[model samples]
Target chain A: MGDLFTDTIVISVLAATIRIATPLILAALGELIAERAGILNLGVEGTMLMAAFAAFIGAYATGSTLMALLLAVLAGMAMSFIMVFMAATLKVEQVVTGLALNLLAAGMSLYLYKAFFAVEGQAMPTVAVMPVAPIPFLSEIPYIGPILFTQKVLTYVALLMVPVVWFFLYRTKYGLEIRCLGENPKAIDTKGMSVSLRQYGAVMAGGALCGLAGAFVTIGSSARFVPDITNGRGWLALVIVIAANWRPSGILIAALVFAFLDALQLQIQGIGVQMPYQIFLALPYVLAIVLMVLKSRRGRSEEPARLGVPYFRGER
Target chain B: MGLRLEPRLAPSARWQAVSVAVALLAALAVSALLLESAGTDVGVAFAAILDGAFGGLRTTAKTLAKATPMILTGLAITVAFRAKVWNIGAEGQLFAGAMASYWLYTLTGPALGMALLPLLFAAGFVGGGLYGGLAGWLRSAFRVNEVLTTVMLNYVILYLLSFLLVGPWRDQSSFYQQSERIDRAAWLPDLWAPGKLHLGFLVAILAAVAIHVVMNRSWFGYEVKAVGLNARAARFKGINVERTAVAVMVLSGGLAGLAGMIQVFGVNHRLESDISLGFGFTGIIIAVLAMLRPGWVVFVAILFGGFENGGIKMQVATGAPSAIVSAIEAITLLFFLTAAALTRFRIVWRST
Candidate 1:
């Protein structure tokens, strides 16, 4: 057991966990906002996918990492706007609309990439990644230095988002209005606030974050986008949102834990273990299932009270 | 004041039809604009799309061939959605069916006669049904959310298929990690001359009609719909909500499984990822576009089939990605969803 603790593989696994968790942390933070607004935006997967591709394209074209990141976030925000219109204004079933948007994003992005780039492979042009902004003296520190300082800009943003989100939700009036709209639109309506606008704003915010998270895969870490590059990270983000009981700070830790499991799976597969690599491949999903089961037993207390139910003006 | 809930009166069929048509037109217009913005000629693209969808006899055959699995999967989605089951595991279920049928076909090829067809179908059905049933069971027993469970199962099944293909069930002789070829006797007969159109097309139409009868005429179908519209009210009416949910799921899964069996027997004659072609999720689009009506499912399935057929041609002609069709389908779903939501309730403005 001590050997396992001291293993180089274990150390590398911890490093990889941070890398993997970056995207999840960012995406989950976004989802946390959307769900907190009583909007179930299932299209996070698709939005991330499109953003990932767009980020790669942008980075590859301009050879500038910042531009790629900005463009990706904009694209994500645009997609979320569509969801907001459907759910907030039109009052459709959030689940169906979200799923449709995801499918649309998946199909459109893949098609567009193939049409424009004319290539299909695991990697793309290697653009300059976001520079690791290490603190002046922190770089000299031991274990925490590499983990905390020597990472992409998105990593710090994702980490910072937890507190920022917590502050935005707990310390601000707008955040309170968003929560009120989610929990009870009627109450918000009675207060003379535009519930639809607040809900839309929250969902759009989530979309922007999801896009940035996806761009992290393209511009921050990998510097490339493969087909389906988002690869269920969006879903994992959804799981993280639930695991955190929709709390922003909790989302950060849950994202890290889920990312750790995913990173652990990769490390286990790499160690040349005798077990079938298939089992390792199955690990993340297995963990998701376990988490879901545990969540189901915890009762409906944790879920947003009015999740997935559309609010109509009058006739309730 | 006390709250009182009332049933929403059904909208006129003419209005529903109009809404669907308007949604389709909106989808096309938006996609056309997108194409134009992307520097493509919209007129040429539209013409090309049409030609690709139904250009010649060959195109029609291709469209029908593609429509086969879509029809079954659409039914799968429709049945499940009608009962409010939300079984998003059709893709995985289809994979399961193909694997099961392929496993049986490879094992019982020589010994099994024409009887192999029914057995293979059964294998596919059982595989899909069991997979779907697992989600339903979890939902009914533990009150687990079916949406998340089904979605998670999809990933599990995908990994399972990939693992099996790359490992134990791999055909060692082949360059690709694929299963051995199934027996020719189990292959579905072709009804078209000099084209890929097969018995599956006719089966799809027949199945659609059969579903229409079931949904409109059968007591079970009525129960499923009632349970779907309102579970609490359905239970109050003495309906077995859990049982109906499970039964609908099983039937839905069986339909999806049959889709897989058809692909293996009718088109691919083997177990592979191409058999799915994302028809499982595409079926969801079709069901939504059709508004979960069986008769309408056929029409929507055919429309999607045409788009898919044309999409391949578009890819060849314009170098557009094949996934463009998925994008269009997704847009249609989004449009329909918004349209349906707006039409469901009137949001009239009133001066305070």
Candidate 2:
């Protein structure tokens, strides 16, 4: 226990925390936008899975990390269109549609992976990881720089996206419109704006970010794609968005905390702790529920007023 | 000339059936594209799936055995969904029930003999009900969103199951991450000799019928449907919305729990991590496809069960991935959902 708190160990844990949180932050930020716009796209998990598989296939085929990322983003956007059509146009139940999409994505990804990469007893093929782009002088700075400055280009972008999303949501006019859409799409419709169009844009952006998040799991962390690679990261992002009270800054903190627990689990396993690893694995989810319950009890519901409600132009 | 959509006052039963057919056809079309891309002949692959699902008595038994849990879970979803309670933790509830029954059977099977079987079912129902009722309580008491809570509970329960499998309840004799097989007297009686078919399938059918009666004929069912259709109105009419919500969830959960126990006693005969492969999640699809009708749920579950059992054969015959069945199920649900929405509005041709 004493040796576990060593400086090197501390820095490595912090680094792992950041590395693990990168995908959540990216996906949460996207979810932040959609949630703000009042569309609960529960299909984030499915979208990410689809994108992750697509990214892996692209990277495996082209050996170019950039191309792989591009394909992932496109795949995510494509999946999001389904949500837009279902929840936005068809006025279907957002939760069920999202669940359906998740199932579709999960099954499709496994099918595609098996069709393209099934080799009996052979390890999954690997792809070239995105090269780390460490800021030269900043990376040299002791604890902070090594942990923050030295990461893959995607990680840096994901970090940078926090502020970018914050600015877009709070500062920009279009961002204001998106927020208004969530709280009161009727008001937006009264303003002669196309509520569906704004929702489409928000969900598409969220989808792309989730796709990038998925790609990072395969390319930024692991070198190969695996089945259900996103695991429950997308779901975690949904919880983070809610726990954060729909605030961008809050999402950053929630993602980091969840990631810290994730990293801690791995470290404890490394230290050969006697406790079952499943307990540690289950910690983050349990904590999220506790946090959500507490947040809800506080009587300050920050949920979008129109969240999960379909917009039909003339419906009362 | 232009086409327009006119909002319908109410959806007709004929249109509802037609929509389902259209959704299935559309899903099949999409599957054909996927199969072709995967290098499997679509016709041959589907034929293989069909043959595998209904080829002979043996295969038909397998399909019914597979459908048992699905039918039970689907009824669980149907009950909760009809009442407007989104109990998405059916999968977790199933596991909780299985864990409860397994623990009870292991504890009392030797000492209590055949009496332990009913006790196992009761324990499973109680375990699953309590687990589900927790979420329902949170939602009704604290206004917590059941969607997130249910989904979160799923992971938590899954981890708990994993922990038990690896730690205390692990089979000591076998290296597998499973528990010791239940006592012979604790096992569900077999319905067919030389086959795995058991009385659990009959139980599923009976459960569906019971659910149908409860949903359509009972006052409790009336309250549930009332709350689902309009909670505020139901409350104004002096219905205890909170109590109804909690009761519906418990019932739904109990059904799901019973499914888990049945799978254990009727099929696996031991607790294992992979005892269920998303039966709870598939229940959602089944419930939706059946339009939340218990009787329809039975037919749909059987259809899905055939697909599930046949998927293995399709995989072996055409070398197509078995996951395609899952994809097809999802696609069909999506199409059905879209068509359901379409029923609310009529397609009309108009001159511009």
Candidate 3:
């Protein structure tokens, strides 16, 4: 137990916490944008899976990390277009559409992976992972530097996205329109702005970000892609979006907290704790539920009123 | 010319059938493209799937056996969905039921003899019902979104199952993470010799029929449908909305639990973490495909069951991944949804 609290272990855990939160932070920020625009893209999980596979394939084939990331973003955007068509244009039930898209993504990813990548009796393919780039003077600091200043470029981008997304959602004119679209699409339509177009923009942006998150899971963290590699991170991002109450800053906090729990679980396992590791693994989910319940008990959630409702022109 | 969508007063049943057929053809066409991209001969692959699903009595039995749990879960989802309750935690409830039934069977099977079977089913149902009821209660009391809670609970339940399989329930004789097999007396007897098909299939069919009657004929079913259509309207009609929601959830959970129990006793004979293979999730697709109709759920479940069994054969025959079937299912669902939407709004070209 005493060994668990060592300085080295503490620093490593903190670093791991941030590292673990990177993909979630990226995904949640994207979800934040979409949800703010009154669109619930439950297809995030499927989108992530598809992007992850695309990125892995790109990286494996080209040996260029940039190419891989680009492919992932494109894959994510392409998948989001489907959601945009269904949720925004066709006016299908968002929940079921999202669920179906998830199944589609899962199946497509597995099929593509096996078809293109799998070679019998060979080890899983690996790539030259994205290199970690530490900030110049900040890296020289004792403990804080290693934990904060040193990370992959993608991690820094994810961190930077919090403030960027916050500004975009709260400060910009377009952001105001997006928020209003969620609360009342009729108002946006009355204003002579295209509700579906704005929604399409938000969903595409969100999808690209989720794709980046998926890419990070493979290229930013692990080298090789495994089947279902994103593995519920997309769902976790959805939970974080809700838990954060749709605030960009709140998303960062929630992601970090969830990541901290995950990191703690890893550390506990490292310390050779007698208890089963699955308990620690399940802690974050349990905590998320409790937090949601507690938050709900306070009052009605600040969920967008028109969220998940399809808008039709001239509909009473 | 501009495209205009005119709202239909009421979509005809004939139109609904035509739309579904169109959607199915589109899905198949898209699936063929996917198969081509995967480098498999689409015709050969589909033929293999057909052969695998219905080539002989053995394969047909395998498909039915696979369909048993799906039919049960489909009925469960149909019940909950009819009440407008999105009980996505059927997966978790299923694990809970299987665990409870397995625990009961291991404890009382030797002493209770044949009576243990009934007890196991009851235990499984009660276990799942309680788990699902928790979500319903939370939703009713706090207006919590059942979707999020149920999805979260799935992971929690999965971990709990993992803990049991790895810790207390671990069979010492095997290296695999699975519980000890129950006594022979506790096993669900097979209906046919030389085949794995068991009484569970019949039980599922009977349950589906019973649910159909209850859904279509019973007062409770009417109340549930009323609540689903409009809670405020149902409240004005003197129906207890919250109570119905909770009751629906319980029944849904119980049915899902039965699916788990059947899988354990009739197929696995031991509690393993991977026993379900996402049967609970697939049940959602089946229920939706059936358009929330109880009778249609049986047919849809069989269709999906064929896909599951056929997928493996397709994989073996063409070296194409069985995941294509899942992709196909999703495509079908997307098309079905679009078709449903089309039924409400007919396209018209207006000259500007």
Can you list the residue pairs that collide in candidate 2? none
lDDT of 2 by residue, A1-316 (tens): 6764698788988988998999999999988898888899999889888988888888999988889999999999999989987888778889888989999998888888887787668887888888778899999998998799988888888999999999999999999999998988888999888898899999999999999998998877778778888988988899999889999899899999999999988988999989888889889888988888888878567788989888777768
Residue A313 error, candidate 1, Å: 2.3
Clashing pairs in model 1? Answer: none
Which lDDT tens digits does candidate 3 get at residues B98-124?
998988876765577777888888999
Which residues of candidate 1, in runs, are more than 4 Å off? Answer: A1-7, A119-126, B1-18, B37-41, B344-352
DockQ of each: 0.66, 0.80, 0.76
- lDDT values of the candidates? 0.81, 0.89, 0.88
DockQ value for model 3: 0.76
The CA lDDT at B242 in model 2 is 95
Comparing candidate 1 with candidate 2, which one achieves the higher lDDT?
Answer: 2
| lDDT string, candidate 1, A1-316, tens digits | 8776666565677767788898898888888788878898888888898788878888888887778888899889988998888887777777788788779888887767766664557444566777778777876677777666776678888888889988998789988887877788899988888777898899999999999998988778775556787878898888778777788777877877887887887876677677777676667777776776787777554677877777776847
* Maximum-DockQ candidate: 2
Please state how well chain A of candidate 2 matches the true chain A, as a TM-score: 0.96
Q: For every model in order, what is the number of clashing pairs?
A: 0, 0, 0
RMSD over all Cα atoms, model 3: 1.8
Candidate 3: regions farther than 4 A off: A1-5
